[model samples]
Target: MKTQKLKFTFLVFIFSFSNLFSQYTEIINSNNPGFSESPYSVGSGVYQFESSFFLKNLSTNTPTSLDNSWGVDLAFRTSFFLERLEFDAALTFQRDRLLGNFTNAYTINSGLSKIMVGAKYLIFESTYKDKSKEIRSWKRRFAFDTKRLIPSIAVFAGVNTDFVSDVYKTNTVSPRIGILLQNELSNYFNVITNFFYDFIGTNFSEYQLTITGTYNFNDRWSWFLENQTIFQQNQTNTSFAGGLAFLFNKDLQINTSARFLREAGNNGSYITLGLSYRINRHVDSYKLLDENGNEIIDTPINRYNNKRKGFFNRIFSIFKKKNKGNKTRNRGKRKRNN
Candidate 1:
């Protein structure tokens, strides 16, 4: 009767444990691809690769010069585990052609235009406005809940070096600081905004503001629109862009975008083809599967820490202990009978 009771109690414990853990939600990292970046971090233990190719045409007055340029921008980013800090490096390569009676018309310059490296840290992240707050205690510290109405805020700083210093005959390093804020209005809509300040060498400073919104039509298709404005001491420039992002799966995305620049001295437009990819980053949902392609019941404690055993292991341990106790009792009885 005692053995039966122990067996019954173990079964009850397993069922209750599974139910409690099944309620937790896994927060997927925000991967926004467009002209503007999202305030959210790429997530810990994750490496992201983003690359874009753009072709632009500009026409300027005074000497009446027309310029056509094509470039590639490549960036890589990585984050630490459970910490809201990310590191990134970026490079830009462009080839430019000038015409229309400029001093040196029809000249082509191709090389690296810009090189930058930066770090971003999340300062504060609000809890999900819904039931996420109530269950926050059960979740891992690393996961971010996207269902929140409140926004996530982060700050970033970087140094940009001019690669073509010889072309303009000026060598300078530009330092930049920026703040990013991101929020999800719903499962279908999200928004990110950025405020930036750039110290351009010893002579001038540039301030910029950018806002972007993304709309999801479904699991595979999404669209985004963005507007950016730059303010210098004596001039201001505004740019607008829109694009479509296609998710081949959760880890890979392809996008194409077009932008128009409105500047006093020059007006121009550019089109970009880009892709973002994540490496070796698996979702929390994958914990539901065990080794042998069998489904396993995950508990809240063991969900984040896979080194710990699941519900089945706990059940077997209980049975093994009970059997050992029974065997010891049986041996005592045999000695008494002898």
Candidate 2:
């Protein structure tokens, strides 16, 4: 009986712990060394930064030009007010040399190329079953959960400004919108997809699609493969990249990746090195529970003064009540016998 009671208490603790941290994680969740964004947000009160530097080379046959460039891309992300919402800003700076094929003349230019600010809100999230409650068969405990197929969905809205150098400015401000989706196939594998319409109502409008797959080798090491495609009025471009990431600690990570690009009469490639770091200040809210493992609704008067009951305290209180009832029944029996 004691063993059974202990097991029951353990299960209740697990359930309560999971509920408390549905959105927050002990480790920082970052999107780095890849172009695609994640559907999930950094938890509330988290400020994260991800940055990368890369060198790219492209040659175009139609334009008869050779481009060699290096750039740094930086993103800032944070969540506040709501756990499902996140705001982010991105900036890119690049220096490039453009060579004319006919005259063999080359010129170099450098400055900020892009600036964007955006917000993402998770619209739908799917939950999985708790397999720990199953006890009859080992096979049932280890079987796949079908509910993993339904992906979590999010929406993004942002504005792009042309506060850039003359060599790379469009002179127009436009709105960008996207849908982000993610499927958690298993404990170790995840897939993410994003669709975006960029530069709305502008001369350089385009559509983009990105698909990425990530696999975790262990707690500290992981790998990702991604493909991004861009479609414009006159041409289409596609790129494929693969990367590896290592988690140095709970709040820091480093990564490296290489990409191959293809377009109509154009080809290019780039290599990137990046890192992600975060400042975590999240605090879990307090919850009160009864002996039966049901939550006690909080009243405004006592909500601020009540403290959460610990595990041992709950167990002791339950057993103490049972003991008192047993003693009362024994006393009544003795009185009847006399």
Candidate 3:
């Protein structure tokens, strides 16, 4: 009887918090902010950093009380050679606290949850310069509305290792792969989809699908909604998150979000805060410089070319050529006079 009341209360709690659940920064292109991953890379030689704190509360259909857990996640990604390929790494620390009625509250578990390292490669991106000519403006430029066309596609793969203890880790490595698709729906809206398969080192593999939609309020603010589904052989799980992002600047952003987990045995909600930063790469275009800081040439070979010519020797050679030309003209004139 009490279990039924608890279940009803849990439903009420989830619905009540629905509006507050949606929010996070749009800077990170991975699953941290939401379920969907962007098809675009961070560009070549660029570095991106993101850190998030998540607190989740679970309300099971028990007679007494709820379970609580929380985690801190940190992720970093960078482009090595080109904008098409980038590598990512992440670590998560989690704690679970479970308490029972008439019993003391105690820490059930605490440790490193997981570590992941992966890479993504951009396979195809549509050119949108022609389409953007009409609507391009300084405002749009600052808004980061660079999505070009339909079906920007990328492939990503990663391995996740579960930490067992300080000296030990999981013997089996779990590998995952996914395809990310992104499209610009309108001037202010974008959608991203990810289809993933995880090899759980078992006979059966897990499949996941995540879709996210984002709306740009302006250059500095955006909102997002995400839905994610995971399928296994025996059971399935679905989750939803909505969040808003505040871009402090082009390079830094902060986000707040809430997530709801819908499952039979374990129903919970997650509240998260995150921030991301982009470090721009340095690109040098000038190859040669003269004394007064004037650019002499645009290619690196200018240094070798200058080394072959001595200053006074070059001057003397020019004068010698002029003198030889005059002597030839005089000889020709004398012959004509004779």
User: Model 1 compared with the native: what TM-score?
Assistant: 0.67
Is candidate 1 or 2 superior in TM-score? 2
The collision pairs in model 1 are: none
1-338 in candidate 2: lDDT tens per residue?
Answer: 87876677667767787765566778978788778888889988889999899999887633335478898999999988888899999999998887766666777889999999999999998788878889998998889999989999999999998888898788789999999999998889999999999999987799999999999999999999999999999989899999999999999999999999887657899899999999988877645554478765776646544543555775676766443343433444445555
Let me know the TM-score candidate 2 reaches against the reference structure. 0.82
TM-score of each: 0.67, 0.82, 0.67
Runs off by more than 4 Å, candidate 2 = 1-17, 61-66, 130-135, 291-295, 298-338
The global C-alpha lDDT for each of the candidates, from Candidate 1 onward, is 0.72, 0.86, 0.72
lDDT tens digits, residues 142-219, model 3?
454354556778999998776544432556778988999988767688888999998667555789999999998987
Instruction: Check candidate 2 and list the clashing pairs.
Output: none
Q: What are the runs in model 3 whose C-alpha is more than 4 Å off? A: 1-32, 61-66, 98-107, 129-132, 135-149, 162-169, 203-205, 284-338
